[model samples]
Target: MSKKINEKIQSIIKQCESLSNDDIESLPNYKKFKVFYSKKSHKTCDIYLLCAFIFGLLAIFTTSISYIGIEHVLYYSYDRIFSINIYHEECLAPKLETLIDIFRPITSCDICQHIDHIERISNITREEFEEKYAYTNHPVIITDAMNDWLALENFNYEFFKRIYRTNSSALRGVEDNCQFFPYKNKDEFETLGDVFNMDFDRAHMIDDDYKPWYVGWSNCDYSTAYLLRQYYSRPYFLPERSESSKLDWIFMGTPGFGAHMHIDNVDLPSWQAQVRGRKQWTLRPAPECFHICKELTFIVEPGEIIILNTNVWYHKTSVVSEDEISITIGSEFD
Candidate 1:
């Protein structure tokens, strides 16, 4: 075996030395290997290239399986086992639960002390907030922030119905442009009125035995946007004259039903104000933050504002009381 290996090495060396100096220089780590193998071994190089090609093909195949097929299998399997429709097209991404379980031994770290409670402030200056929290990607709840907003006093189901439903002309462009997301239901509503008219009371009663049913939609219509501005002013904590898109979102539902765990795909941070009832929010750091920080959970009462880096955290919200309907209005900002 020793003699045979020596003969093979000698053959490789001779083959390696036959290549031009320029060609040899082009090869990675060529100078180091040139001391022993002075010739190019086309067979050996072909074998390595073949192995890389196979690996590349395998990577593409695996990704296709994961993205196109695995989600469907997992979705149907989960639905069959639980007898519930918990899967949504928006949530087809690989779950953090699975990733955590697989990588916990390697990724787990000390729970960050700051994760215990989001910073609570009553009268923080915009400069102070932007300096401490906004730029740092920290989450905070500003208590007594929207105390004077008319939305706190007049914004409710009836208020919206009176404003938008009464004037069909105002909703002409917006009624069909927005998409409605229903809690665990696949039904799609074409307009805001259709969503408001959902059998929420009955759904709330039935949700006692099943997962909670919630619904939400974005306020993208020009008339609806104008209507919302009449009741709610921008929170005092946000920077004055900050540029933000006119698109805002409204979430309304009873307790036990709300948004599921997911990160926002927005370009900037966001603030959500609880205009009615109360909401409990459970926020987890993005998978990248797992090694440095732990999850944070808290509640936002009516009239309170929560400013958070929704783009960096996986968060979900649920109403605190079943009796009182929950209404929250949120918008993104720079």
Candidate 2:
């Protein structure tokens, strides 16, 4: 408060600075003085406990999930997550049949044992498909099932990006309400969202040094599905009494990249409509029947829809041409 006090403080500091380290340490005050510490507070512990409890609940919380012939579907219905009015009844159809089919065991080994080639057919009626191929292990590529569909002429990379741009189910190709498979592009792209975000040249592979990407994801958005359904309808060959899941699965990418060899655990057989480019399907028998069955490869051209029980077949796919990007849309029917 006073000049005298300031002088006294400076003198004490000078004396302390002048003292040797050993002298300062030897002081009685330094030796007897204690470092005061209050008891550890429970506030920090409470905060950590609260955070752990929250995380535990979040871990148990899950999104809607059911098999729809896609690799695996983490798909939920529109009504569960959004306030939008329902439009498609297939979206709300009971998954109990799918669940039952998933657990049902295949009793016959004769199906795969005698299979050697994928049958190609055309102008087949519902009775024909049901009698010959629907319940059989023979994979078939129907040549005319997609002939009347507009998807053959208009479905492409750009068209897909435009329709799904506002889709909440698969926003940016992330798993908002659905699942996405990057396939071979997993190293470079984590999701369909990443592939769509790339530059024009790289995305279409317009240059020599471009990177190739192949991806697949389920279409769960009701509005987007409605737009897609306009371009295509049920295959004429599917049994008239069969049930169709409203969900659609899409695979799109440049040539030289596609899905690797893998077996699916879906509830039923699926069909893939080749809308733009040629794709080769290589089917291998399941491990149990490998000794008796052989691997078969078939090329599906544009406007062709291939129906195979992917659940029992280990399959691999490759783009068949460099001239066009491969685009396919498919769904499961029971």
Candidate 3:
């Protein structure tokens, strides 16, 4: 609604005009332009008439499309590191570092700080976040994995013991092994297992009492569901009302288990943070490196965060804890 954004929409419309019909059609809301014709002036002006008619039809069609699309769309001119401050017209990465430092102590919760960087770097207020960044349809960069170590050192292991005493199903964490709590949905769990190239038997092994080195639970909405398990991590925004902002939360079940390389749903970004134990993260840019990245994996330490522009590249992790609890935070962006 701001004048600056209005100009941006106009600029995008101009850019769209230069694109080919095929390209325009590939975008959402432009299918109407593929058809529809307008009236012409003179009978003798056949060629000129058709040109004028089509232009008029396209002009009206594109204008309406632009108006609607800009409401929920964001167009970035750069790739990978988008570190500029479009709002203040200044570089924000440095300020982001300052915020990280300031919140360093308070944010150290064993539930872990996943994607704290994205939250810290996001200087937008809750209102502005709702109005602008939420709807931009851009990937949010979650970072600062290293912040978790602070929380890990402060956690009271005896408190966790109290939880285990009351709830036997509550699994104790191991430092080296990846462990997870399984969900009730078998089919959805299997589907997620397939994404990780695991068979149902191998995946379901987490349900066994043998206590493997690592474990993780999978279901239709594991990420979202996991967040719900904790009372403090309620979502602040939804996709329909406002633009999608990042959803960040701590994952403090066990250690060792990690995600595999894969693209996110059509419009999402993500970052993983480590609060306790350790994880190795391998990152590859979305360029010529895509294929190699898909085949490789990485390890990250307790204090590290992996920034995943889920829209662009693939990543996988390896757990590094020996026999201690591991806590992590996962963040998603729109």
Candidate 4:
């Protein structure tokens, strides 16, 4: 971090310390601050103390309870006694984007021109991929690999509705489990039926200026995972070490809307298989790699898969086809 950025963060911390709870809650960015604070509370003093006490007492009887279980308990206990908004730093960081613009070098990477295209392969062993691309931060597109996937034939809006709508055990409308991105509003749908009922094409046909909508979710629920696994399996190029089955994610949307520019937080590289329609991805290296790496823009068509170190690259996606809906299944791997 730059000195100016550090000073700005410090100034925000000082201002936050002097603010009362009501004052903090009144800020325009309070909702974002609340989410950030909730994520951070697990690392604070109170959680550490509770974990220490619980683990200490458990040690007297049996070591049955794992550290992972204790960590989850800490995560669930979001109530904090301290009134100060520790997450005020995030609220202020967005505001400093313009002021800290001078810290980045203006020089563009010339190598980008030479590397205009991502590597495309039809058959590659898992060992080859791990050695050449996995940790080295190179991106590759694998073709002819997902030809046998049932997802290519069965996954659609109707399939999702059938699996989730009538079943009482189906998971729906959980903000952390499922998300709906409306073209105009931040409000999400309440159920899977709501998503399936959205007439994206008819809406655009009726109104010339209508924007598209998107729906995305991870297989965080057992029922959802069980249904989805019937259609798709793990990509073959992925090493055995990858926990791809455990962290699967699915994205569904009409052309014109997809994920915005952002970096993912993951311990391993990720791969996304385009099951239907098409998507254009724009990937840029992190600020540290800006000088050495060129920004890449590429299209991923149906039946194709792309693997990249998303944790190191800032990326965004857009639907490329005007009429077709895009459905992508992806997962993180070690």
Over 4 Å off, model 1: 1-114, 164-172, 188-191, 199-212
Q: Can you write out model 2's per-residue Cα lDDT over 100-119, one digit (the tens) per residue?
A: 44465653567777777777
Task: Locate the minimum summed-lDDT window of 10 residues in model 3.
Answer: 107-116
Worst window of 10 by summed lDDT in candidate 1: 104-113
Candidate 4's error at 52, in angstroms? Answer: 46
Count: clashes, candidate 2:
1
Identify the leading candidate in terms of lDDT.
Answer: 2
Checking candidate 1 for backbone clashes, the offending pairs are: 15-39, 15-40, 16-38, 16-39, 16-40, 17-38, 17-39
lDDT (Cα, tens digit) per residue for candidate 3, span 43-144: 447888889999998887577668856422222211114432233222334334334333433211211112122233323345654464444422233233
Candidate 4: regions farther than 4 A off? 1-116, 173-185, 188-193, 200-210
Model 4 lDDT on a 0 to 1 scale: 0.69
- Cα lDDT for residue 116, candidate 4: 53
Scored by Cα lDDT, where does model 3 land? Answer: 0.42
* Reference-based lDDT, each prediction: 0.71, 0.75, 0.42, 0.69
Candidate 2 local lDDT, residue 309:
86
Better of 1 and 2 by lDDT: 2
Instruction: Please give, for residues 22-56, the per-residue lDDT of candidate 4 as tens digits.
Output: 99789999899889898888568688999999999
lDDT of 1 by residue, 154-190 (tens): 8776676565563475444445565456654434443
Best by TM-score: 2
Q: What is the lDDT of residue 327 in candidate 3?
A: 59
Q: Number of clashing residue pairs in every model?
A: 7, 1, 32, 0
